[model samples]
Target: MNDTAYTELVMVREFKVSPEKLFDAWIDPVMMRKWLMSMEATNKSASSDPRVGGLWEIIDVRGGKEYRAVGRYLEIDRPIKLVFTFQMPQFSEFEDTITVNIKATEEGCKMVFTQHIRVPVEENWTDEDTRRAVEEFHDSSQHGWHYMFVGLKMLAEEGITPVMPPASE
Candidate 1:
């Protein structure tokens, strides 16, 4: 009966690091730039305000094209959970919500990452069209998150943070 189409993609990752450390990697701008930037990206920058209602932004340059993502923190429970809104303006105007739940474990921590994407329903589109759109978006978003998680796992286990670049004059 809902007019809008929405889907939730859930992913789980366990890391060999404490919950606090893993949680920081999610909000810390410098650490985010290191891992969130795709391997092919040559230049990347990130800025964040790690508080509820705060805003965050990241920009990555690949082949001289900039890909930017912006978000606002909706909920923040340090070392435990975080919920935020994520959107890439250049790609789509629709905003998606992402929730990260972290729990301490014997070895380290477990993270349950869930992304909720809501696609607006257009009057002109058929049911089949809406289904395909949701499926395609869900698959691509899952793949992207999987790639980012690989980097996050490496960063968390390594325990060595990457140095920040020198500021331009």
Candidate 2:
């Protein structure tokens, strides 16, 4: 068995908002919940402190089961960049880092998310295996992030929140 495993996935999205406002939403839990929650019907599953060495925790419930990701903030540069660790409590074996970069464009904001996953060598690391894993993560994350941004745009334009279906429903 191999001793280590690694994978990287990157996703990008453009939003019709200024970089500063978009950046603030990323760091502020209150604002983050408006878009980050898995279910639009509920509030954020947990809280996060957007500072170096701070903790980020979220408890998401689906089908009456709870899922969590707990980690520490490694870097936080407002309106520009953020890097943090990610861990799953259930498996306890998956630990990773996620970095978000925000750049301002003439028309709006360009946000890029990069997720790095490191796994045990026992886990399959074939080319196909790696490609599938990264593709899955990239697809799911892109969808979620796009949804979040859409919700954010609606909030910004109308001062109203968008509703999403519950995972249970």
Q: Candidate 2's C-alpha lDDT?
A: 0.71
Model 1 agreement with the true structure over 1-169: per-residue lDDT tens digits = 2357999999999998999999999899877887765532343788899999999988988668898999999999999999999998988788999999999999999999999998767778898989998898899898888777777776789854334321222
Candidate 1 Cα deviation (angstroms), residue 40? 9.3
RMSD of each: 6.0, 3.9
**Local error of candidate 2 at residue 53 (angstroms):** 0.1
Candidate 2 ranges with C-alpha deviation above 4 Å: 119-160, 165-169
**TM accuracy, model 2:** 0.76
Best by lDDT: 1
Q: In model 1, which regions exceed 4 Å deviation?
A: 1-3, 37-43, 159-169
Give one digit per residue, the lDDT tens place, for model 2 in 40-119: 45553668877799997767666677777688899888889989888876965667888989898887889898888665
Candidate 2 residue pairs that clash: none
